[model samples]
Target chain A: MLLSPSRLRGLGSRVPPCSSFRPFTAAAAAAASPTSKPQVYLSRSRNPYLNLSVEHHLLQTTPPDSTVLFLYTNRPCVVIGRNQNPWLEVNLPLLSSLTARTKPGDHEPAPTTIDLVRRRSGGGTVFHDPGNVNYSVICPPESFDRDKHAEMVVRALRGLGVPGARVNARHDIVVDVDVDVDVSESDGNHGANTFKISGSAYKLTRLRSLHHGTCLLSSPNLGSIGPLLRSPAEPFIKARGVESVRSPVRNVGVGNGEFEDAVVAEFAKMYGDPDVFCEVGDEAGAVDGVEKGMKELLSRDWIYGQTPLFSFSTYPTEDDPRERPSLPSDFHLSFEARHGQLSKFTFVNASSAGHVDIPSSSSSSPLDGSRIYDVEDWTDALRSYGGTVNSQAETAGRWLNGLFGTGHAKTQLR
Target chain B: MASIARCVRAARPSVLSTISKPIAATSRPVFYRPTQRCFSATPISEVRKYTKDHEWIDLHADNKTAVIGISEYAAEALGDVVYVELPEEGATVAQGDSIGAVESVKSASDINAPVSLRIVQSNVELEEKPAKINRVPEDDAAGGGWLARVEVDEQGLKEFEGLLDLEAYKEFTATLHE
Candidate 1:
């Protein structure tokens, strides 16, 4: 039933669209309004095999206030934020593994291709497939409040009877279950408090706007998704090991179809307000926009040009010296200075027989008088008596004298 | 792959077992969609020349230099550009060669050189913070946000004649309306 704004205004009382209100439009008043609705548009289709041409057409041409609900059913696919680099966000090997699973005779039309699609928003990477429903709320900038709109959608789902269904701060609709319960209550709390779900992003043009996301109604192929969407390398920390990074809560599809239908119906009702909904297929303008965007998305420079250069530093360890020793007396010393402060010192000795003594009071020996020997004279004497001096004595003396150094003493006894 | 699908299919029964009942007993009515419009107006000026890519160049009366940026329609189409990569000063670029890139949250597009020219200055603020591009796409030295300035070549001046005039581009874009 059409609920024109002018007609709704005439109804006098400001009844919310969710209420069982009468159609205020004159045309609607004359026609019999059906109470039960069929064929609820969930959002735009999230089909991987969705024609890019059609997708572009719809986006460029669709008028504002058009709500398109799509059910994405197919193999797993990676959808990147409009401005993100696929190489930076995705694990190449994992993607390759998922791609390998595709055989020549997979299906007649072939399941939606899973490589990468640059969406028109600034969110993070999300895995999509048939089990998930992708929803797009295209509206005017004034009508779309990111937080409020997401909350409204969540409220609609809760209204549909999904127990404990609440919109997280990140704009994701979440429910609690007790299977393995791998998802930490801590994480759920963080999501509720932090307002982040898998990651919701948006794009608003002058005339057309869209905020789209995946509602994982069913448990996706975790084996494929987990392996494919693994996080990129991170700093080595025990708590955030690769295994921890890979763990994620499976989608709700692992539950029942009746429940899924109820959730889907609720979302459809929330998105399908006759006052807010405009039904239109792919049009020319959106197609042109998509074509332009696709051209840019597929461009070599656009795809790979802005990558940040990465560099790492490597320093030689004492165990792996820069140069191998050729003679028994050969030795090397390395020192590090930072901000004019002596930070570290390392020494390597390749002596075969003679005791290498670093005597205290080398000043008295007429050797380099300024040289501070770490070893005391008595300790050096004792070490010298041993066929070859391998000094724990020198190390201990260095500690006592506060001449901080790290070194390896190599010697062969005669 | 099929086995994985079967696993998901098998788990479906268990997934529904855990979902709580709907919060509200009564179903809510549906929501209404909104009407959207596209920005298609083209600027009007004899001195202003437009690129097929939608960038416009306004040649200064001095004839030696010109200010260049995406057309108003192009900017609107790109949404809020968060970052802009500008060409380096002293670098010579050919007409139509990509000089830099502009990134919005949902999209990224290359900024092609409208004329064969030598870059004299680049907007440094964009390097440190990219959101300035979205805030002001045409602010020159006065605003501290103009993308770049370039010394135009003789051939570039000749090529300018072939570009779309204001009225022609406006009409061209208007045809795209639904």
Candidate 2:
């Protein structure tokens, strides 16, 4: 059954063609009756996968002429891209083991599920917390324009009296923190462009495509994000997945209590008719599809098993000479993986340079500051440590006596 | 290797599980071939034909099978290929339908079927080392850098005729880039 904009409040059980909405062009948009802008859905579910499923559902089922905007939130989690490696993108060990305490020091109510998930789009990874609001735009392939949506976001933020909200060359919405310097004049380092207010990604099917991004209305402070992003446990991990560029991010609605509603109102005014909004779960049958999509997204196979083939290696040297001169400089751990599965795993104290290469593990270390863990045995630890790419790194940490130093660290999968 | 096929199957369970028309046609592991090595047995029998989307399908004398891959212009345009999402061996595709995608530093482009055919073998080497697509000589791309082998009978051969010859496709891509 075809869905007219009027029927959006309810739906037939059957899914429609990819281009099931009204045939729309800019001229047709102007001449069209009533639904002038886009269809808006506000998702109440905080489950990260569920919210993503809702966006994919709309993208998969929506008509070409129709434009859709999904504004939702997720409980804290790290989301990977479709073609990314979780081992390199996130600190997998911290994500799997962290316990979100319901009461102080009580591990029983550990509700924290800070795991990695792969999104069906091409871009870098992103972080989501309850304080962050995500916006996704699904349009016809011809109608998809990331710049327009970026402009709309900046325009909406400006309407909320937020200052210095503008899109940079990378198409990220950055709020200039420095009062003295313009963003363009600053160095290209993402860290210098503090307070990345919005991050976006895009995907295309044969018929329609969608562009989705995160908006920081208010969020747990930026430092809380570093843990989910990467791990300090491993000194460094090298992989070739699409790595997320890191920039200091800030909450747009931090001081203003009304900022969430204000930003929503602004987006509704710009992208939708305030009257034509749909509360995602309000429809009865749609929840099943969202639930299915949610289950699909939450699967371990989808999350970890989809990562591109990569090799990750870490060198453990003197972390800080002033603190611990006892630690030696030549210890290294390396692993090769395809789809997050390990192929070659090795750990060695190479006194000789370039002795430890995968499928050939040959290296011997002096008894100086480093105690020998025997290069031959750690391979078993890494293979057993494997569920996600991040887990393997954690196994290396455990077997070698946490040489890299534990605790959460975050980095992109570049 | 079956491992790569297993990985692809796991990654795209929904699509592969649902499509019942094509039998699993992927070449099981014969042995590890170097990414740079050209298959000496399957040389191009006929001149190359190009799809508007930049894929070149070389149908040797036996019109029943053809080797297909992206064009030199496409390889040049795609920049460095970080990943290539290949189709399952048994999957059957209609002309112009997307079988898989090729991801580069720029963006991911859908790999379309130039004509209706059954996938017989996927280049597992590309899955292991995607840059090989860029490494193969551009002039010999249709022979050296092919992405997959597809089954083409008389009907598939008729469909191949509608595609542009090498010179026409080069001219076509020129107009697009300009």
Candidate 3:
């Protein structure tokens, strides 16, 4: 049975009626009728949260054997894997600094913030901005083919001028930067050859599967996005989410008009009639699931707490105020975080209050004549003379967590 | 709910024949505590049915419990099992609902419930070593490939009406290659 509009649109009241969006759904009644084309809900929503909700709704509501395409672009957001930790995936400090300056140099009405969204599919975190476009293919699990879905984008891009566009073994659509397409050789000096244009991820159910990905177009400055994609500031994460490898990326067109048209055409040829395709909401929160997805994606719990359990160890360097001149520079803080919550916090000071002469830290530095109790290892470092490690762990946990405690999912990139 | 004794009775030879192994063809001594034979072990011993989605349920002697897992064909197709998200304990799931998921090669496949029942226990060993499913999916021994144990009874067997028998499932998967 197909979902009733009310059942699907129970979350509708939260979204305003879209002037562009038609109220049609793949209801059982519609499925009961004949002579209609395979419906494509081409949403106008730019909100990533809403766009993804539409994708999920499409995946769940559509019949197992039916095929449909969903297309949209989101504002700047860093979406991660369902099983990944946000702390490890996003560069928090860098995301906080993006100026929401539009192309004409006017700031958007809303303050610009990098969003953190965990996708149901398993893949590395990705960056999305208004300049990028996303497409998802929902079909029966038996009919779903990974390469076939990715090939649509490759063909669409090639038709729009990227001749060298090809899906790599990693399922990324890449263009060799060094080898010019002779069309749009990059004008930047990023010192990278292969620029990924599209990255794909998939989620499967008993009857159906959905494959979705993004195309980097002219809006996002690929060079600028590189900083936010870097590893976290503290490197305290060790979770099992697929890590996003830093690859050189490129935007195909300066504008999305040609590319979007090509996509709509290719999907129609491959799946149904192009003329049948109709546009949906062109604004954020103009459809269902946006309100629910936003609440979860915007929450500290889902973004940070969903991170896989990890352990981190930090040690103080030479500038610690609690350091004694004759003491070794080994003050370590061992910590463990589960679902992004600190589970174990410990502080160890493996220094003996003795003046025994020890070698300097590394080959570069010369040791003063004083005794050095430098802790070289946490497992087998110098024996603690008279300090408590548990108390130190608690003290350090409070201090470090206070500085980097829970905050909004919106973070700094720079 | 008061129970007399809990024992793992081995699946009968007819059910074991579904596995493509030499031992399956032979009359292997199916181990069982001779004491529990007083209950209705006949229903489960007769055969194991498979869902179209490739899950199988092996009901026990009492007919109130079942061990469910993906078929060997599914394990083979999924490549190496990296993670298995088993259903939570005591979660009452209806027939046809997804109980959990199995992630392999970065793609996750939902594991569905064949019968409406509450989850009794999940294979905790799969949490650390999911590859065990991939290694010996056809094996009936402990920690081979079973995903969960659920509360099922004579009425639960009614849910298996539309499911395929071992031979039928094999035939269905054969058409997949075509």
Candidate 4:
């Protein structure tokens, strides 16, 4: 929703005594020191929701040391990472349907609306709604600690009785669920599977302001997440249903009223700081900055700015010279480095099947209609042809190596 | 309520006394005297010594070898560091010269050497994990996760006097916040 600061202020004035919540006590405020208590601004629309633009404005124009708390409600939206390709991260068809259904020129969408926005962080995609509350903690670089900030969120959740809400190494908070299974076991249940409840990512700017991700207590349509992210390498996998990388769990909305009330109370207490207050003038500047950022994000050029250029040649195999059904044969690969790191990798092959013949022994099988052979058998056949084995493997081996190599390459550059 | 009021009244005198003591003690403005001040050399403690262009140095004992990492304040302003490039070990760098580059998620930054020195080691850990510079920059003191360590020349030491001290850096940062 277009929850500009002025609109919020106007709504605040109209709200009744029910809007008045307890301010944080001095002792609680002191305990939350060093990490300045983010100003708690209760958004006052009937919808009580904010958009990426408004949050971005707050980040851009707020004082370097100030932290902001955005309390939103009853809004649904999809936000993408700053460096991510939205086309790769979002379901185009689903988004089109949502947009078509949404009324034009509406500042706030009706209940069950979807707003698509982009964030200035490097990470995956996320879905937000009123069922979910997003919190952005913007402060000076020295004031924020990645792990500590994450823990604080977890603490807030726990205060609402969602105990054992531990953050994963990747910063995702997960809950374990038990589902009916068709197993031979007597209990007819499998091991506990983890379902991701929240996902977080962070960005630190030269301005010393830090912005990160927080998706709280919402049961997003998990089935939608897969279709949104398109992977060129696995089009077939896309055709099949996309499996969630993390497990599934119940959302916080399933909790009782006391649970919800406790959460809001804890957040009010946790993010409280009497030393700071809203600066009305800065909010206007923040809105301008956010508008500019939204424009840039919406631009197709910035969304799909850089493409990995690949160069490869193909050779034909006798079995499938006309058309290779699966794997292409006789291929050579080359990767080009950009910004001092490998930016693109190209594969060239000439096989009758139009696919490369990977040894059965290798983790990956030949895509063409070649006979399956184990690793030793494939090596023996290659050796017979005077082919020398190299460390690079087209299948699982290369994939694993790339994981470490890519990480190493990025680290060295940093 | 009475106890709280009494506590506030008792603490008020101490707070006022502490505030007034500083102004009262410095009344004798001894501007000409060369006072042996602990930080007379440089006011910014964490900045190490710096070059004229604002590159700071962190020197080890014996004055010959030291690890180098950017100041905490420098990293903050650079924002969302995505990549960091450093000079290779055994490479030589001079004071105020660009030794490497640090690319943020937004832009690229040059890592300038504060003093002329030869690179004895480079933090190879950064090759796979550049965020280390942002996450744990202070840990570079023990030669772990440092950007680079270099041997400085005597001339470089003379240039160190031009850099800011801890106190000066605090003032500098305070201005940025304002």
Fnat: each model in turn: 0.15, 0.07, 0.28, 0.01
**What are the per-residue Cα lDDT tens digits for candidate 2 across A1-414?**
323322433321232211212211222443355544556566656666667876877766655556677777776677877788665666655565654432222436346556456787767778776667787777665444556677777876876777789988777898877644543322333446466888877665555666778887655434556666765433444455566777767666542224344444555555554323545442322455666776677665566666665554554323222222222344455555565555545544444335534234343212112212122244344444333233344444454433322222221110
Write the number of the candidate with greater lDDT, choosing between 1 and 4.
4
lDDT of 1 by residue, A1-414 (tens): 433334433332343231211211211332243332222222232334233333433434444335433222334566665445443455543453344223222343334335555554555667765555555544444444455445644654454454455666445555655445444422233333221223345654434445665666553343456545543321110110001122243454322333334434444455444322222222211334444655555543333332322111112243333432232234323322211122223233434212553222232322121112122242342244232234443542332222211110100000
Model 3 spans > 4 angstroms off = A1-28, A34-36, A97-111, A179-191, A233-236, A274-276, A282-299, A314-330, A341-344, A350-414, B1-19, B22-46, B138-142, B153-155
User: In candidate 2 chain A, where is summed lDDT lowest over 10 consecutive residues?
Assistant: A365-374
Clash count, candidate 3: 15
Single out the weakest 10-residue window by summed lDDT for candidate 3 chain A.
A364-373
Give per-residue CA lDDT, model 3, range A307-383, as digits (tens): 65555545333322233222123445434555555434444455521232222124222112211112122222212
User: Roughly what TM-score does model 2 have, to 2 decimal places?
Assistant: 0.66
Return the lDDT, model 3, position A66: 66
* lDDT per residue (tens digit) for residues B1-178 in model 1: 0111111122233222211222111121222223522121221112566666656676554456766666545544455566565776788888877676665533335577777777777776675556555455444434534567667767876677678776776655443331
Candidate 3 TM-score over all chains jointly: 0.75
lDDT of each: 0.42, 0.57, 0.59, 0.43
RMSD of 2: 12.2
DockQ (Cα-based) for each candidate: 0.07, 0.09, 0.19, 0.05
Displacement of the residue B161 alpha carbon in candidate 3, Å = 5.5
lDDT of 2 by residue, B56-115 (tens): 786755557777776655565455777777777899888878887766532455677888
Q: Which candidate leads the pack in DockQ?
A: 3
TM-scores, all models, native as reference:
0.44, 0.66, 0.75, 0.46
- Counted clashes in each candidate structure: 45, 11, 15, 58
Candidate 2 deviant stretches above 4 angstroms: A1-37, A99-112, A179-193, A233-236, A254-276, A282-292, A313-333, A346-397, A400-414, B1-56, B71-82, B88-98, B104-109, B120-146, B153-178
Tell me how large the interface RMSD of candidate 4 is: 17.4
lDDT of candidate model 3 versus the reference: 0.59
Model 1 Cα displacement at A224 (Å)?
5.7
